[model samples]
Each structure stands twice: as structure tokens, then as C-alpha cells.
Target: MKAEAERRGYQKKMEAEKEREKPKPLSEKILLQNDVIFACKDIARNSLNYPDSFEVENTNSGIDNQNGKQIYYFTLDYSGVNAFNVRGTHTIECYGTIGDLSHSVTHKIFN
Candidate 1:
């Protein structure tokens, strides 16, 4: 009975995963920090749209910047992203792939 319940849960999880959308193309944007690693297999940065100085790579795993600190990670399965640095102003767009999925991230940097 327990095994059967687990099987059902697994099936539901797989179904939900299949519903995730593919990523989009890349765009231009402003990033505030250096060595910003977007650790994701599904997501990749579009090199053609970016400059040669910007370094982008695919990691087998996710971001590992946090050291012994509690951090929250949110998995986004979509085509667009709207991120704000300070809140209440500005817009910037960046793009990458999420596996075979392509998506864009809009980040705002403020000082």
C-alpha cells in the first residue's frame, strides 16, 4: 500500500515536470556582480548576444556560492523573467537555456 502511494506521487511529479515550458533566446542587460554563476543544466547563456568578456558555462550541477548559509532556491520553468534589485524601478533583460528549454531573466541593479 505504501509503495502504491509512492508510485502515484512519482507519476504526479513527472506529469508536472513535463508541463514546464522551453527556454527562449538571449538579450542584453546589466549585471551588478562578478562571478555570477547560474548553475543549471537546462539553462544556458547565448554567447552570440553577449560580449567575449562575459563568461558563461554549463555546470553539471547548480550554483554553489553559498557557504554554510541558509539560502532559498526557486526553480523557474518559463520563457521570461522579471527581476528587480532594489524594488519599485527599472528593467533589464538577459537570456539563457533551462536544459533544452530557453528562458530570459530580467535583472535590475541599483546602488
Candidate 2:
């Protein structure tokens, strides 16, 4: 029983040391509101019909609890005629974090 207790205590100490050596997530706020907006606009222009007719709207930002990262949410509104000569509007919902804007998720809300 004494040997077993010492082994368990040594394992716990090693585990604690490993946890302390792990790298922590960045705590600095590096991205600004305009940066997120610009990234969204760029994505919209590349994937939508008319690049010049889209605008960013309804932007919101919040900190994610799981990873302690800033998450930005916004919508893109496009109003113009497509290649089919049909005039209509489109809305896209987008979200992304500071260091991962290029991989932002965009979903077409309506068309």
C-alpha cells in the first residue's frame, strides 16, 4: 500500500508538470471591427454575382468561451442582376475568428 501511494503521487506530479508546460492561448485582442468587415467583403466579392453591389451589415462581435477567441458575425447584402439578367437580392451570414479569417464560414441566408 505504501509503494502504490507513492507511485500515484509521482504520476500526479508529472501530469501537473505537463499541464503547466502546455502553451496557453493568445490573450491579446489583435483583430479590429474593420478587419473583420473587410475580410467578409472580400469573401462576398469572390463568391457572389456582383462584387460592387454588396455591402456589409448587421455586424456583431463576441468572445468565444471554449477557446477564448474573438468571434465576429456579420451579414452581407447583395442587390444586383446576375448573369441570368434576373434582378434580386441575396443575404449571406458569415462568421470568423481573428487568426482564421481566410477560413471563415459563409452561408447564404436568402436569395
lDDT values for all models:
0.31, 0.62
| Residues 1-111 of candidate 1: C-alpha lDDT, one tens digit per residue | 999999999999998787665454443211211112343212322221222222222112232234553222223222221243222221222223332122333332221
Can you list the residue pairs that collide in candidate 2?
none
Poorly placed runs, candidate 2 (over 4 Å): 1-30, 53-69, 98-110
**TM-score against native, each model:** 0.20, 0.44
Question: Which model scores highest in TM-score?
Answer: 2
Q: Which stretches of candidate 1 lie over 4 Å from their true place?
A: 22-111
Model 2, range 1-111, lDDT digits (tens) per residue?
A: 999999999999999999999988644244444555576667666666766655454444454543776565666675556788666666666666655645455444566
Which run of 10 residues does model 2 get worst, by summed lDDT? 26-35
